[model samples]
Target: MEKRLTHFSSGSGCGCKIHPAKLEEILKDVRSDVQSFPNLLVGNEASDDASVLKINDEWALVQTVDFFTPIVDDPYVFGQIAAANALSDVYAMGGKPLMANALLCWPVEELPAEQASKVLEGAKSVCDKASIPLAGGHSINIKEIAFGLSVTGTVHPQKILKNTGAVVGDVLFLTKPLGTGILSTALKRGKLNENGYEALLRVATELNTIGAELVAINGVHAVTDVTGFGLYGHLIEMCKASEVSAEVYFDKVPKIAEAVQYIQEFILPDNTFRNWNSYAQFIDCPLPETFAWLNDPQTNGGLLFAVAEHAVDTLLNTFQKHGTTQFLLEPIGRILPKDEKIIYVKR
Candidate 1:
């Protein structure tokens, strides 16, 4: 019999994350002394993808950790998606992962040990593709099956990117289409077709290695990976961090076609609302249906890059030269001058 990994958890994948608003409230009064450390290039204050610490004039260390419950029924695919999601933080920071450690929470009493081994194997495969070693990790016997990685990567000090570096007039690009959250919801409901499931796995498991390449481009000012926060939530963070507003062309944003159908059917994850409520005040969307995607929490998701307007063509050409397909480099919007609203979505 095939073991369905998602059945063990109440919340699947990144959808299990704490609501952004609730997280803010939890961290509001907390203070970290690490900010005083001069070598810390990037810290929690910026709400950036990864924390970077300068090792010297030439290099800096990038650190990030991410984990989530299974979003897919297959243990292997869930492992791949979770690892990819964790590795994305380093890529978003313009760093190449060097090593990683596993973070696992398994329900030993419920799920078979073989299933857990397959999950680790899946994660190991992704780590191998990223050219990093899974040196060690910690695990706990828990009520649910959770897996992820704590990755350490490195980049040249000057090349480190942050979500806060976006400037007014910058162009925004998303590497992958939105709607994984929606698709996962459909999967849970057993409404997703085989093709839709394949699409979900393909996108979720894809590595965002291009982010390291993007750092070499002088025009690329800011970079971030859209995860549990959703597209708008992450973009709002960028706007606030960079002190700029944005104009998102809703029609231009890429999405899984099947997800739209699911949305139309009212198949959506709970995180969709949690994500929207967290930052609804900062966004202005003309259509109510747009909320289905604008605030949809993604699992592995995509890298959102903010590049200079004039460099769009050059960046596209570079991507082409580097074998990045056209679909992955679509421009969805542009950074605008600061306005009363942080984000203005044009339908």
Candidate 2:
């Protein structure tokens, strides 16, 4: 078999290929097949980040696993980003990770196992920084190099956050800027600016430690980290689960400064169109021609949280208190009345 040559192929990560419609289709069958258990707080019925299983009346266990192929060239950085990304799902659901099991798929014939071990070491470094242990892991020889972790976390039963809890009038906030997909794609094409390139690596490698801590502090309502599903893809799920409509101010969205220029140059990842075509249903407002391209998928992205309207200031202050004053927090949208199915995006 020929070695798979790398291309500036898919957008940032798996989220780019995920069309909102295709996900709904797959969910239709899976949702029908699965039986609901009372102890499950969040599951397949709604596209939530992690599954919450009751451990006791007061505590619940949040568990999530995610793995993906190389999105960057540096093995250590790739491992760090992958580990942070996997642990993010637990944080998205407002949980403190306890332990993680490493997951790896590498081509032993094509790459050295020592290199893979280094990747695991990188992931371990990240987990350790978060005070979580890499308890165990599973590996296999595969056609491509991939790595991530299956993390178990805990949160108060009353505090278990899900995408479905955003209430009407709640303000939406994103802890990181958009455009990771575009920056990474440009990097692969050798077209990325220095600042954009730096931004992508910085955000991807940074843990969601602060965001998770903020969610636990209170006032945060619904939460989900941006991943393979572009921003709107995840936001729509939040709206649907919360039974609310949303109006997003496109101008307010934080994009990497150079992202719009790159899109204007028509440099885009293939997943851009795929994401647009999939999640265009809930969107009712006008979008710029470049909007589709800018909403590209992200990997190891930041946390998107909806806080009570009055709590917006508190959230931003809390973030500043944690030294994330430059997090690019923005009010891209607000929850609207339930039963209004539209997700309006506008200038």
Candidate 3:
């Protein structure tokens, strides 16, 4: 029998993410105004997935930055996950990234600079795959290892998708399975199955470029990535921003095949509870058995989109045509009447 352990010897993806409550405390004192910008489509007050600045009447600029400590032991894989995670933000906003700048924090005296170079190479490789340039970036000596990218993308002003745009009757779709957090937890403890470990690595290292392409062609009403706050937390943000309610069918939500057994083994990331607590007020989950699984933090998870019922078939067909058939398109819920509040998890 495989023993499920609580902590991983090594971190991976956003499983290494800081707790939302602690993060909010750190930024609580800092002040920023969203009202000051007239052309900004997404910004601070809304808890948006990314930032958007209108470049002109027809085009808006998308900018986002993400960096984190080493989640995996391998230097190259760490670089790939970090870069893919960072670039996902742009895709979440329904935009094609044009440029990215490397953000690195490393130990100058401890780790070899060559290791950092490999991280950069990993990031550049993904950028090349996306046809974007690694123009320039900044580096600094720090106490621990950190790597990511500051990406800039562009989308037509009219086409910009915001977390707050879902209307009632829209169908929610998740493109990828959950459990990156749990699989990564297993890896750190050296308890991971060989195939499961490799499966997660492949998924995490893959970019969301194809998913974004689908968003562009589908005319999605709302979009966001599942990151540190986990699926439920981010769902709360979408519900509140759009002033709508969502009902998620627990069974329809996708999970990596091995993840269910892993959960029974108690292999969960430490941050899962943190994510649950941060948005617990907004979520009315009827089942207590699902709390941990639904709130598990994901690193480079899938895109969650709310598309109009009329467009669902077209979007699914186009996504399949573009070789994104691997993405799970289960309809877990619907955008409910705006008066019901943010989220209602059903059995």
Candidate 4:
């Protein structure tokens, strides 16, 4: 007799995305069209976080739209997670969010409209925190529940962060940990515990505002958010685009404590396999058993940054000095000159 949000979800958060390799298949032709428009600074060609269109000599417009089915049972919390996930793109590209419109889909007859209002309120609360306005959105009647934001922001034309530009000797770091996908899957299967839920909510709701701070950091090179394709998948995108390879330390990469337990217990999201299959050929995994942790898709995840070796301290100091959100910063790996393998994962 109670209403549940995840009950209507087909996939949780970014886990709902098309599998990485499959997505490449779908976008292959679309990627070739990127060169047709010279003003399109960052497009699908590089697998960057958001599309950056140059506006003038000084500025470029960063625009992205993201939506996902519920990742939490509470409508309000689900709304927060979805909005944070969508806004992450702008930050990943080193832009500050300016405004947004809502995206909602629900079964009107099955769920009360009041619940949808709660979802909008949750998204609005996050937008307000980011100092952006939620102007409007489009809604539709659908069988499954979903919500997100169409965010627009601005960045200096010269400073747009792309997946390209990660040079060799660049130290790598993930602003957050992995395992949102696994935990959200556990939640959907009714197997997740309170600790797991707390972990998921904390990571999903925290905005990746640290991205905006990176614009001032000279060391920050290529940056991308770890999302549906998992950390390795997104990192591979960065490597291929930047024409560099990586050395990811398996133990150094952070993970949610609860989610780690869930994985050890053999709880995994379907996307884990989807992600691995998408790019498994390109990686050299010395520890094959740890692949699940490495490829677990994330929801509203952290920004993965490639910082110059000399600027590593400057980058970490920025996180400490940002003084707004707390980051569980960890140096997971480093960029290497392109080798036959795109990534080499070791303990």
Best by lDDT: 1
lDDT (Cα, tens digit) per residue for candidate 3, span 1-347: 32111222234567666676676677686534557777877776667767889989978999999877666666777788888999999988888899999988777776777777888888888888889998999998876667889999998888777788898999998877788888877777677887777878877887887546655555478888887777898787788888888998888888788776778889888788777777787778779867766898888888887889988888878768766655375687888986544788786
C-alpha TM-scores of all predictions = 0.97, 0.90, 0.90, 0.96
Ranked by TM-score from best down, the candidates are 1, 4, 3, 2
Off by over 4 Å in 3: 1-12, 22-34, 214-219, 339-341
- lDDT per model, in order? 0.89, 0.76, 0.78, 0.88
Best by TM-score: 1
Per-residue lDDT, model 2, residue 309, is 72
lDDT of 1 by residue, 126-190 (tens): 99999999899999999888999999999998889999879888999998899999999999889
Rank by lDDT (best first)? 1, 4, 3, 2
Roughly what TM-score does model 4 have, to 2 decimal places? 0.96
Clashing pairs in 2: 15-228, 15-229, 20-278
Better lDDT candidate (1, 4)? 1
Question: The CA-based lDDT of model 1 is what?
Answer: 0.89
lDDT (Cα, 0-100) at 181 in candidate 3: 84
- Position 256, candidate 3: lDDT: 82
Which residue pairs collide, candidate 4?
none
Per-residue lDDT tens digits for candidate 2, residues 153-217, read 99888888788778888888887777877777777777777787678788788888765676555
Write down the TM-score for model 1: 0.97
